[model samples]
Target chain A: MIDGYFSLYQTRSVNERKFSNFGKTEIGMQKTGFIPAIPDFTLTPRIDQVGAEERASRFTKRSIKKESKVNGLKLVLNMIDLTTLEGKDTEGKVKQLCYKAMHLHDALPGLPTVAAVCVYPTMVRTAKKALLDSGIKVASVATAFPSGQASKEVKIKDTKYAVDNGADEVDMVISRGKFHAGEYNYVYDEIAEIKEACGEARLKVILETSDLITFDKIRRASDIAMYAGADFIKTATGKVQPPSSMPVALIMLEAIRDFYYKTGRMVGMKPAGGISKAKAALHYLVMVKEVLGEAWLNNHWFRFGASSLANDVLMQIMKEKTGVYQCASYFSVD
Target chain B: MEKEIKKSSLSVSENGIEKKISPKRLEVLKTYKIYIGGQFPRTESGRYYVAVNAAGKQLANVCLSSRKDFRDAVVSARNAFAGWSERAAFNRGQILYRMAEMLEGRKIQFTDELMQQDVPKAKAEKEVNLAIDRLIYYAGWCDKYQQVFSAVNPVATSHFNFSVPEPTGVVSIIAPQEDGLLGLISVVAPVIAGGNTCIVLASGSKPLCAVTFAEVINSSDVPGGVVNILTGKVSELSSWFVSHMDVNATIYCEKDSTVQKMMQDKAALNVKRVIFYDKINWNTDEGQSPYLIMDTQEIKTTWHPIEHIAGSGGGY
Candidate 1:
């Protein structure tokens, strides 16, 4: 064995002349019928140049011209403060939010209507009634308002009721108690049950990112939700101050990407709650744009459930398109 | 694009009714048994563990495999190696090819399991198809890889030397904890492709799918006892695999360095070939291709002399 090894080493040494540049520059000798020792390195030329030379061109001009085109865009309006809307006042507040979304929809007729108007379940019927004929979708939050400490039956009933009341989509919270207790199966089961209850209504399984707290937890939760039949894996309820940060969004998007690759499932995404401005929504969109690509850019696959976000995005679009900073008041309030 | 749409429409039309009813809506309870030594036997202890789906639903009651069960699987793997490893490579390839064909027939069944795991319908279909295609890919490699890795040398010695890749004998694999079906097949197929008999620990909480795979292997002409699978605690079963002096090699898919090192250490007693696949990413091209694993096995070298005789000597 040693002799074979030594002889192989000797043969390699004899062929050292051919191995220069890891055997890349041996074509000339090969034409003379000498079998070349070539390291297999397949190269496909890229469209763009690599290295510092490419950077030099951009760095020479500090103010580099950024070119972008507007594809189809969706309005992401988050309905926060769902806590006060439960029980007796639930229907009233939901109607108010739905009316607000409808008025906003009429005002910004040229822009895409917010994909969904999310709220607590009691308001589901009110939102449905208020947004009737407006083409705006009604999304109801179930499985306990914020804590997600509820029984599977209750969550399912909540989701079913919302769906039954004309909710176009159901946004249900994962059982955080189970999720926190490391009973991921329980959380996944609850989400699956809720998804079953949704029937034709799209199910958005909210991970409530702030509760998850870590990227790995976020990823695992995203997987659990998507695996348990989530049409969309939303970040949080927006009740948490840190609604949906870019990093958290990135984590969820990556999990979705992996799920898609492994399962060939294209899950939608919604960064709800904390996104109070257009820039925040754009940043979340940018993360989605980078992580999920064009497939997740549409309303069907991507949404921002923010209430204040509609006016903000409208103002920004107006500013960019018309070359003037439109005041929040100037942009007619819905 | 139009052709693509047409093909999609055809597929959709075929499974439209089934697709309408998600597997989540159709609950089926499974009763699983231990697939040890190529035989379906109840656990030696007669104990069973309930396996939960991703949704925390009790899908199947899997056998509670014990230390004896582990040993049984190992023994079966060792016993079956003679016939399985000695089978003609072309024949083995044909068996693997047939297994893929069988898997194709069960695509709907596997897709349902994929959906139970919460895989989106579109994605579940694709993953099942990929798993089937992967089996076929490995089947094709069984016969061809021997030529690719084997070597014949022009030595300065009088003997003609040639090396041909052979099985590394009985192997033990710890399947990846996640990725129910794909992960199980990923480890099992490659080990068999190289003519090695394997005893695998099925993915916990998802053993139903693995047992289902065992059914495929059984139907595919894989000799009984060639691929013995134990579904239980890795912590409990891994020690038996690592300490076994009979095992020739072990394939570990875990990310824990401590367990990896421990497996490496225990494998040392018998001078076993310990393959720490810490770098094989299942998401990468290398992970998906069975050829990457087929390359890890050893090629036994043999020597023979080519004689030249004088015509005059032969005539005398």
Candidate 2:
């Protein structure tokens, strides 16, 4: 009975793939007649608020259990951008967080290291030195993160400092005030300039979705960032409440999918902050798989920007192995 | 003449035609759900067992809770521990007393549930009353038990040493099977009165009163998750309750030696405090004691060094 249901689901998704291709072609035809030198940011598609929310919620209801759940959890652990962004962040704290990223739980053998350790520009050198030869990347949040209230020159210098300090990736926040004021070109130009300043580092544009209250704005911000040469579109800066909700993530993922169809370029998606549970992490994975398909399932294309999510995932993995619920005291605090 | 006229009116319709009346509507039976985190939820497993009286009549459908339910309850209990253990001892006493007040108001309901489980009318009433009194008993002990148990020691050296009882954190309990209401109350009241949260597995056969008691705890000033109760079989859930590393203690109130051995063996993994009350009769005075509260508490000893007594000889 389960096999039959899966077969039916498989066929329906195949048909959806074809239908989406047809829709993409129609949008392409509509754009060909009046193609301009610069892409029109205002032409970005508006999001269906209720439909996106319903689709996002459906991913959480999929019961991935036992072996499949373990695999999903491991993938989630691997895709984590283990982050520690604070004003008091020091070399010692960065080293400890780097150690945690590498050795999540040495007691459990064969566990995968996280994709990267995220830190501030000043801590990038320390993180790079500590994570040397560990196959872990160091991502730095720049462009006046959490608030893009500084001058563009300062933001460019911040990006340069991180890149020069050996940051493999740069997470930059978009100016929400400008975006909210309908200055799409300004936000686009800022991301493009930051992308250039990043040199060889991958640029992750943080939309700070809490600042953009509506899904339409989130979708437009996603489009502006992607077209402006962001390698990844992130949800928040970890300093905001109501951050990185699944619906916001769904809108972003849908934007990635549509961009992939329109330009055939894949921009990664990162839903950072407020997602700390293993189950919630798995739900995000499920959302990525269904919306963007299997090509974007790896850490290179998807990431979780979080601080405490590593411990929760490790605790769950241990529980699965030992059949005993674990306590937080037994795990490291870093 | 008035009675005849009313009967005719009842048989007649609004249009003045004679109509056949239907029987009275049957009341809808309440679905018994598991209580966790201060909210009642059906078991995530969606499996239930038919609870039957001793006469083989089906009483109600009780949730056949799975290990996941116990895990969730433990999570809730652990989350609630910090706030609950930090409350003033006198405040905890007042909350337990409030639970007693709620239970007293629902005495007849509990009595009916116990009678459904085949207890005699007088015995069921006595059990309900004892359950209420048990809460009050623990309520009075909440503040005083620490004074009775703690010690201030005289040291040979110039040091001050003292030992005080602290809650041992989250406790998991497999309630007694036979004496459902009173036994459950006897075990749970003391644990929470001493400021430790617990996840209790109610009696498998006689689970009605236990779930109803959860309702009582819910309405009382007692915070949510301080006393989560699950209605299920102990045989299936005892290992989970005992082996959870986050549970600071385990209490088993069954005569099954196999389960007792398993509890001890699995509890060794976390070195959890495992207490068995298999032989105690709930009706006897042996059921109530401050020691029961002590079973789920840990003693912390502190020593403060002082200047040598000879150095303070000026005062002498």
Candidate 3:
């Protein structure tokens, strides 16, 4: 009787169902007017039931294998002094590092070169000249690095000059004083104007989520940057201690998911600096995959702005795939 | 034992006035009229029907009410609804309590009328007594229905939100025919309890007791014309009342299932509430409770804060 009554009610209400117009992809189609069916364990099991002895054996072996890989990925690449290079004690350090990368390129050929040789905007010319024909890109931190408390005209001029001088990417920091003062519309417009000045240069909008100190604020900053035409959303300026965490990354990924749904445009995500571990990188990657799906797994959408993360991923993957632990002494520290 | 029974003779008074041998008597007839527009006027039809005693003797010639009376009753109800619905709930409570007081005073009078209408003595007394008590039951609920049904919802932070109880105006109640006096009081009390005025159709075949119940209303401090009682065919009035666009809701308390369904179908014209009293045992003590009145009332939910946001500049 209850079933009959429910069926009657359903028949009467059949015409009332409405549809939502979002993306036209398969995921979008499934999301619109979708009611999830209750899962039955009789149809499928969620996890394999392993015995205590086998689990203990696998856990110990996994721990031992993980330790050796982390120790090897720690490459202490001494940062070149761009500020001291005004005809003062300029010792061809950029040349030395380029040559070292050339020699060590074969051993860790799969590893990424130190996230594009970061340098001062003035030394961008020197780095470009030294690293020319080496497949390495020049990344210049523009908009008066460290503190972005400058006029819009000066910031725009600074960004345009760096980009015109052949910088592949411009990592610009938001004006934290105005941003912290709840002047988000101002911050958004400034970032948009700076990105426009970059013209062909890839724009990385630095939210400094650590300084913002709240997930809600971090999420809002990510949204604001994306709305104002940011090519990529980056976590911080790498100046604050405890620069980035999973919650901050989670918030950023969620914002991207929502923004993409609204605008059908994907914004790349970059977690720069303080991301020194392979496992931490994989964890951030897992968060992205969980929230934004497999489309964000590629290099075009996902970038780790660290000098060391690529080497660590290779070390861990090699150990896991080969069933043998390789020590740190096999590779030279570049 | 035989002594001469002499004829009584009249004695002449010293002031030349004759002593009265026979006592003269006079009868003052009571006038019964329809209370309309705050005045008691006899039916314009100028026709009357007989309300006979149980011994098949004529008691009085009562007015034969017509559809015009029902329409006039509706007009009275619509006029009273505005002022009554806006009255403070506690003030309504006081008025209802006063109504109960007035009904209790006229208890013996109602019982006598019920007896004359052929109701068994105990049952007549019980119906009259319960009618008085039913008023008190509803009177207490004037202020409580709001608390029970209304709520202050925490809407997702965009604005101030609230809801409160309001009346569905001008109900047409078809009082139950079985338990005449109590049923009439039962349906009418709840409709007016929530500040809604009503035009009630008394039991057609047995309207004597119903007409007497109106006397209680007239004597009580009940606002004139808030409740207009009519004694006519249910089929005719139910059709007219149910289809009337001005009537907000209807309550059908008669027992005939066919009439119930017919009234229900006709009631759909304006979607009047056609209640079936057979579904309820009107004799049950709980049946006559104020729940009947409150259940029919629409509770509007009103919500607001008990305090205002307050702060100030001061020396720290």
Candidate 4:
């Protein structure tokens, strides 16, 4: 069943995929009522498990020293989406997270604020009000998040509620049960509807690659989200074990690279969950540079869906400046 | 006549066919690695230095642990503090006694390692025995030091005020540079017996026994990271050991004034408790005192609320 899902990508010739984009924006093509043929869901390019893992490991070996390390650490701090999606989240907790997003180590001058503060739909208004005038965007998770097990009306309403509360970005989860059941059309139409509900807010489609399991399915899901007008593709909701490993992230990055080449639009990538270490974040940046080049290096094109990563990057920067390792007690707890 | 006798030892035949003879055997040397977080790992920097005795013969290739090694050790020590500090005092005594038992079974190895660092045979044996006895001394204090030190204050109020000692969390220690086995034990026992975890840098010139002692510690019931031992230069690691913010105290056993002054200054960074053991000899009874265990303990005082006055006739 999975092999046939990938065979669809094999059926579409590169020339045909590129010829359809003769200077037409993917969104513009949609407005003209010309929907590209749905992926055959019968075939995809098979990912070499060993080769992908080997390539991803090499990205960690490049010595990012002295100047590059400091700069990379700061960039990591800026590209973070400080997330708090707990069931016990309160208005005060969301406000505190927003404050951390803006004042990340004010002791160190000239540090950029994090890109956004991610919260649930109920807390979006509180975050939006707390982070006002800080220039940090507010992102909310919708579509029965972490597990997309809701009806279409409720899911669309969830996205609209967050967007109505001034969420700049809507992070919606793809229905994993349907995707795993090989209901590719159901998943694609659902993402397209969420994209419409998002309106002006950029939509991030979470594939939850931990549940997807294989590199081939992750790649196919990335293709599905991109064609269905997802502004960004995120790996997980920070709610699963073994979330956002390098090999799975590599497959998604390759998919983004291919999609950018075939279609004129560029889709951003976010490998969230389990990315808490400063050194590991730098390695992810190395993977982005190697796989998708420099275009996806900034907050506009890439983001880390993390909360703890901010403190680690701040600590590394402090270690560079002060020549001493930092204790977690010194940093504020989220 | 000498050449004929030497050839006969090999038993070469007159027909030019060599008779069966044993090949000369090669002696294998041990590579002494540092212990961190319960596992024996080579120094992360992959650097090593040759340790030699006073006679100028090489003893072993010891890990030249870098500041990064100290950093890793501090992390392990910090991670282990919670469980080790909260353990029942009697259980901690049992574990320390278990360590002594492990050392007793391996005294010959410890004695040999001490002798390899230039101590005479009789002195080496004596030092090993002293080290084992010191472990027992600390094991007994593990459960009794609080009773001797704790007191109830006579406050003229309804509240009852009392103070007791608690472990001072992770400690960074530089073991004494003399009598390799006994000196390391003297410093380590007191710190851990008080319920604190520590990362110790063994004697630079005499490091063989430190690694062997780590082996003994691994087999004991004492948890990993409770006592991490690193073999490296004191000059390179002293500043990092004292200045780490997470370390609650710093112990320097040597009497070098400049390093002592430096440790005092750097310890101020985190207000770490700095201890000096420069003038003491580990082999004496002074080294086995219960006061050594009190050095790394914090005296916590609490006031209990009472519903009745202490001496009122109708209060009871």
Stretches of candidate 1 exceeding 4 Å from the true structure = A1-334, B1-28, B308-316
Candidate 4 CA-lDDT value: 0.88
| lDDT by residue (tens digit), candidate 2, A27-71 | 332332311123355555666778887878899999899899899
Candidate 1 residue lDDT tens string, B184-284: 77778888888889988888866777888888887888899988888888887776777765678888887888898888777776677877666665544
Model 4 DockQ vs. reference: 0.56
Q: For candidate 3, lDDT tens digit of each residue in B107-211?
A: 887788777778888998888778878788888888887787677666543334567667788887888876778888888887888888888877755676666
lDDT of 2 by residue, B85-124 (tens): 9999999999999999998998889888899899999999
TM-score of each: 0.43, 0.90, 0.42, 0.91
Q: Which candidate number maximizes lDDT?
A: 4
Decide which is better by lDDT, 2 or 4.
Answer: 4
Task: List, residue by residue over A107-173, the lDDT tens digit for candidate 4.
Answer: 7999899999999999999999999898899999999998989998999999999999999999999
* Model 4 spans with C-alpha error above 4 angstroms: A1-38, B1-28, B311-316
User: How much lDDT does each candidate structure score?
Assistant: 0.68, 0.87, 0.64, 0.88
Tens digit of per-residue lDDT, candidate 1, span A1-334: 0012112112435434532332222332233233322211111011111321343233223321112312222433322212223345656666666666655545345555455676677676777777788777877787787777777777778778888888888888887767778765466556656666777788888888888766556766776677566889888876776666665666667667766765576888877776676556555555566668877777789877665667666655654554333345454443
Candidate DockQ values, in order, are 0.00, 0.64, 0.00, 0.56
Return the clash pairs for model 4, or none.
A4-A42, A4-A43, A5-A41, A5-A43, A6-A43, A6-A44, A7-A42, A7-A43, A7-A44, A8-A43
Which candidate leads in TM-score? 4
Please tell me what DockQ candidate 2 reaches.
Answer: 0.64
Model 3 chain B poorest ten-residue lDDT run:
B307-316
Chain B TM-score list for all models: 0.84, 0.92, 0.80, 0.92
Better of 3 and 4 by DockQ: 4
